[model samples]
Target chain A: MFEYIVSKYNYWVYIFLMMLGLYGMIGKKNLVKKLIGMNIFQVAIILFYISIGSKVGASIPILTAEDLHGSANPLHYMNPLPHVLMLTAIVVGIATTGVALGIIIMVYNRYKTLAEDEILEIRKKSGV
Target chain B: MKVFALLTVIITGVMLVYGAEDFPKWGDPNQPGSVHVAPRYTQGTYIEAGTPNIVTSVVADYRGYDTMGETTVIFTAGMACILMLRKKKRGEGESNV
Candidate 1:
């Protein structure tokens, strides 16, 4: 049981971080706070994936001649797939954040307030 | 309203934690992820793309198409931001200029 918990510590930390982000996203009233939560959530997810690519006794994925000479061992290097995919995910996340902030700006310009309740009230009144 | 949001968050967190039980332990060499197509990329990087960094080879060589799309997404996002936020001043109109 101790071994299991120790080995899985990274995942547990990620899960906790994910919960924190989720809470921020859902429980917060401010729109900008929700965006911060979203960024936290993205970073946590990226960290989780990068951790998955780790190996107990491995170097980076750049191959040496020994890696080719002796048996071509996969264990000699950390997994590279997750790193590659997460790079794209990070770029996408930045794009999404930029767009979301832009939308928030437009929303604030029209509604004159960033509070969720006030915006809803204005929307209901203005039939928007 | 806050109470409802908090309740939903707690429920989701519980479900996520429960689901995490089945995931492979950290840094386990034999995990399916490490054994799968990862080996091909690691083993074949030099010959396939002449790149020492496997992440670079796989991202820019094997998956160049996806990267192009991602670049387009960011560009579109920038254009959208400008289009949404920019206001034309009365004196700056094409006819006036």
Candidate 2:
């Protein structure tokens, strides 16, 4: 039933995006596409963590007098863990992207093509 | 061989992500991870480390060595890429010369 399918929507969406990234990584023939897949895969982890931290009926975690002194409302407390972790992950992702792009540019300069098969052929002919 | 590879992916994916029920509920006091004995190093993180978060404490303190290892891995990969992509000398370029 749709209810059953939607019961755990956050995790399901995360898994779906992760699988999509995996498929793109494996099925693509071009280096750029592979890099895109790698990005997607990394972002998918960020999404997974964010989803796990999410709570129904939760509000953002900025403190106000209504929240602190008044009777605490459990329904509106946001999880602060993933917000912290996602910032770290985004920095790491950017560093990896820079490295990957650098390698790709170098690869293209040497081989003059982005396709893995073409690069391999050129390497074979040139004894590289 | 292809079928085996597919099976492995499917099995592992299912095992690791079994949906909301299997994971420890948020703020669940009885969860194994919550009940597990925390290391002594994690205790000081709440105050002296100036980080209220415990997981960050675990990452930058107790498991600080692991972050260093990840940096090393990245450094090694960068070095390997440079080595692989380096241009050959004129003599090397002219292999049949």
Candidate 3:
């Protein structure tokens, strides 16, 4: 069990980070805090995917001169698919954060508050 | 409410950890992910895409359409932010609506 846990400790660390982000998103009242939590969650996921592509003794996903002429050995390089997929994911995450912040700004402008509970109270009072 | 949030987080974490147990050990070359198309891409990237950097070729050449879509998504996001936050011009129609 110790060896099993030790071998996969990276997953454990990422899970912990994800849980922390989840807690921040769920427990915080402020909109910006939730946004921050969401960003953290995204970063954790990206890191997890990047880690999935790693090899014990592999170089980066670039071919050397010998590798270029001969058939490139997959084991000699880290997996590149995860890194490529995560590149798109990172772009999407940035877009999400940008739009979310814009919406939060609009919400604050109309409600005059950033707290979720206070905004709810104002909405109830105003019948909106 | 915070207690409820913590409980939810703990439950989610436990489930994820349980699922993660099935994942291959770190840096195992024979793992399912590495055994599949990764080898093909690694072998053919130079001949097919003429790029020594496999990642750059995969993103820009192999998955060009996906990258294009990603660019569109970012453009949409920028437009949304501008539309949402831009101030009204002076003497424009009623600002309340």
Clashes of each: 0, 0, 0
Model 3 ranges off by over 4 Å: B90-97
Q: Largest DockQ belongs to which candidate? A: 3
Q: Is the docking of candidate 1 incorrect, acceptable, medium or high quality?
A: medium
> DockQ numbers for every candidate?
0.51, 0.14, 0.74
TM-score of the second chain, cand. 1 = 0.87
TM-score of chain A of each: 0.89, 0.88, 0.95
lDDT of 1 by residue, A46-119 (tens): 98999999999999887777665324578989999999899999988998999999899877877778888888
**Relative to the unseen true structure, what is the C-alpha lDDT of residue A14 in candidate 3, on a scale of 0 to 100?**
90
| Candidate 1 residue pairs that clash | none
lDDT to native, each model: 0.85, 0.62, 0.89
RMSD of each: 3.5, 6.1, 1.6
lDDT of 1 by residue, B9-95 (tens): 788778977887898888889998899799888878877787777889898999999899999998999999887778868667443
lDDT of 2 by residue, B1-97 (tens): 3355455556646765764457654443343432233322233444445454545655676567767866776676677656655676766654321
* Native contacts matched by each model: 0.69, 0.05, 0.75
Higher-ranked by TM-score: 1 or 2: 1
Candidate 2 C-alpha lDDT tens digits along A38-98: 8888888898776665565655544334433334443344454455567567766776777
The most accurate candidate by TM-score is 3
